[model samples]
Structures are given as structure tokens and as C-alpha cells.
Target: MDDLAVAIGLVLVIEGLLWALAPRMGRRLLEAASETPESSLRLAGTLAVAAGVLIVWIARG
Candidate 1:
């Protein structure tokens, strides 16, 4: 859908800005994330999904 494509594009733009402006910090964050436990990452990802859904639902309403 068009909305999904725009959302993906926005994510890419935000991520690109981080790497472009602070490559070192981005690399360090990646390293930290790699060292983080799988369970923590999974929980964080789940929370992010829930939050995103809630935001969209509220915005649409």
C-alpha cells in the first residue's frame, strides 16, 4: 500500500540521517545491540510494534 511504502521510506530516511551525521555513534550502537541478549531485543521489538500500532490506531481515529 502507499502508506506502507511511505512509512518504510521515512524509516530509511531517519536511519540514513543517523549514519550520515554520526557514523561512529551508529557503529557503537550496533556493536552494543549485537552484544545485547536476544530476549532483550525481542522484548524491545515487541514493545516497539505495540507502540506503533497504538499510535496508528489513535491517529486514524
Candidate 2:
């Protein structure tokens, strides 16, 4: 779908910029993400979902 394409493109652009600007930090972040505990990762996912819901609610108002 067009929405999925646009989302993928945006993600690629953002990731490219981060890779170019701070390669080490980006690597560290990626490694940290992989090493993060499942419980903490789940918490992070929940927080992200809550934030997304809040953003949508605010934007729709």
C-alpha cells in the first residue's frame, strides 16, 4: 500500500541520517536494543503504544 511505502521510505531516510551523523552512537543504540531484557522491551513497547494513542487523540481533537 501507499501508506506502507511512505512509512518505509521515511524510516530509511531517518535511519540513513542517523547512520551518517553518529555511526558509533547508532551502533550502540542498535546493540543496546538487541541486548535489552524482554520485560523492559515490553514496557518500552507499551509506553510507545500509549504515547502513540495520546498523540492520535490530541491530533484528532
Candidate 3:
């Protein structure tokens, strides 16, 4: 639970920094994402999750 909280917090900080530093880019990205197909988005999300799990597993070991 604590690890999950920390991971969520880190994600928020990274996302916040991107928007803070590059607001226009962030907006453009969001717009692009909105127009992106759902299947593509889901595939990207699935890959991200798998990569994250792999990272955590390696880090823990």
C-alpha cells in the first residue's frame, strides 16, 4: 500500500513537472491523445503497465 502511494505520488510529480515546464506541449499532447484511436491508446497503456511491472520486479530483486 505504501509503495503504491509513493508510486502514484511520483507519477503525479512527473506529470505536473511536464505541464509546468511545457504547458503548450502538454496541451498539444492531450489534444493528440483525444484524437488517437482507443485501441492504440489501450495498447500503449498495456505496454506501460507491463514495463512498469518489469521495472519494479527488477528493482525489488
Candidate 4:
């Protein structure tokens, strides 16, 4: 749980910096991410699950 929290916090920090430095880019990314196809979204979700599992395994070890 602590590891997951840290990972999420890091993502938040990075995203915040991107928004601060390139707000337009962030908005474009948000729009693109939202308009992504369902199939692409599913693939991205699968990749995220795999990556999260790997991170948890590595951190817990």
C-alpha cells in the first residue's frame, strides 16, 4: 500500500510539473487520452496492469 501510494504521488508530481510548464500540452494530452479508441484504451489498461504488477512485485521484494 505504501509503495502504491508513493508511485501515485510521483505520478502526481510529474503531471503537475508538466501542467505547470506546458499547460497546453497537458490539455492536448487529456483530450487525446479521452478520445482514444476503446480498443486502444483496453490495450493501455492491460499494459498499466502489467506494469503495476511488476512495480508492486519489485517494491515488495
Best by TM-score: 1
Alpha-carbon RMSD, each predicted model: 0.7, 2.5, 0.9, 2.1
lDDT of 3 by residue, 1-61 (tens): 9999999999999999998999999999999999999999999999999999999999998
TM-scores, all candidates, are 0.93, 0.66, 0.92, 0.67
How many pairs collide in each candidate, listed in order? 0, 0, 0, 0
Tens digits of per-residue lDDT for model 2 on 32-56? 9999999999999999889977976
Worst 10 residues of 3 by lDDT: 52-61
Candidates sorted on TM-score, descending = 1, 3, 4, 2
**Model 3: colliding residue pairs:** none
What's the candidate order when arranged by decreasing lDDT? 1, 3, 4, 2
lDDT of each: 0.97, 0.89, 0.97, 0.91
Which pairs clash in model 4?
A: none
Better of 3 and 4 by TM-score: 3
Clashes of 3: 0
Better of 1 and 4 by TM-score: 1
Candidate 2 has an lDDT of 0.89
Which is the better candidate, 3 or 4, if ranked by lDDT? 3
Residues 1-61 of candidate 1 have per-residue lDDT tens digits of 9999999999999999999999999999999999999999999999999999999999988
Q: Give the TM-score of candidate 4.
A: 0.67
